[model samples]
Target: MSGDVRLEARGAAEETFVDTVHDLLDVLFERGSVGDDDQMLFRLAVSEVATNIVEHAQSREPIEIDFALTCDAEQLCAVFTDNADPALIDLENVGMPDADAESGRGLAIALAALDELTRRTEDGNTWILRRRRQPAA
Candidate 1:
């Protein structure tokens, strides 16, 4: 594990998925030196993404979701993969939903909070969230 850490987990995309991933995150960050603001952003983005998968990822039975978290000197990165109906992912020109709206805002929140928020479809769906510790000079 040297100075870097990577964690991987897979479970049904149920209501408890967020908590499961977050517990791993808490341990990883505690061993490092992430600031409060960056930590908060990471937690918020991860929670939102996990919740979105639980609610929106098109599935009849509980689908399996894979997670990875990497922390190193340059940045902190998160990757999530799910065997969801890939057609439901829409990452183009996303906009925040109204305050009264219930859906369509999770991606927006993640995008606004993280340095990089990207999604791709391969064997399934993948979302990557990265935050840099130092600005480019």
Candidate 2:
């Protein structure tokens, strides 16, 4: 893995989420591995996963987020893992909200922002997000 960065935190979901994203972006920026568009997408995806952990994963023991970034032969990839229950989400049936709805849009936004998305349940839910970087011209 090329460009790997990992972060771990435990606290109120919102603060931890924000800190995690900021740290991830800081690493990307330091490596000059991301562009404006990539940064925006990362923000969107990170928010989506973090919100899911806060809202769906009911845990009083503080949420744990493990975030990693890496590069393979094909793309730059991000992986986020949490120990919260995976059963809270119905991935196949992500119901849409009304047009006037103010929330429930995060999953859709995350799906659209990433080039590849996958979820798996082992110990908990692991969200894998992949974005193919443009080849240098």
Candidate 3:
């Protein structure tokens, strides 16, 4: 996609965001903007991040969030901006938990599928995830 596909919501459930990501990726796929492998990886990372935000962000009221995705020949990117408490985890040190663990795998999974995953909290919490596209053979 030349521009970005955007969604803005307040206190949306994880499923909503995840579904939106899938739908957006479908559009990109139909447009020949990304390959199947890229779409699958980006969907996985976005779903994990959306679930993490909905489950972990502490807020007495509904959290407002802006989610956007973009794709080009070289890469795909997703950005999430939330009006919730700053996420306090170390993005650089996100590690997968033990296999038996039920939680704590979201960030790790996202990191593995992404070339760049970062979080900033200057004006609310902003998360950016990027994955480089593979060369077409």
| Top candidate (lDDT) | 1
Report the alpha-carbon TM-score of model 1 versus the true structure. Answer: 0.88
Per-residue lDDT tens digits of candidate 3, residues 1-137? 45544433344645576667667667656664667788788889988898788778776667777777777677788888887888898987889999999888989999999999999997678999999988875
lDDT of 1 by residue, 1-137 (tens): 24987888889988888889899889878865677777888888888988888878885655899999988877889999998877365667888988999778888888888899888888678989998765333
Tens digit of per-residue lDDT, candidate 2, span 47-120: 67667766777555666767666654346566777776664666666656899998888887787887877889
Best by TM-score: 1
Better-scoring candidate (lDDT), 2 or 3: 3
Q: Provide the TM-score for each candidate, comma-separated.
A: 0.88, 0.75, 0.86
As for TM-score, the candidate ahead, 2 or 3, is 3
Off by over 4 Å in 1: 134-137
The 0-to-1 C-alpha lDDT of every candidate, in the order given, reads 0.83, 0.68, 0.78
User: Where is model 1 poorest over a 10-residue stretch in terms of lDDT?
Assistant: 128-137
108, model 1: CA deviation in Å? 0.7
Candidate number that wins on lDDT, 1 or 3: 1
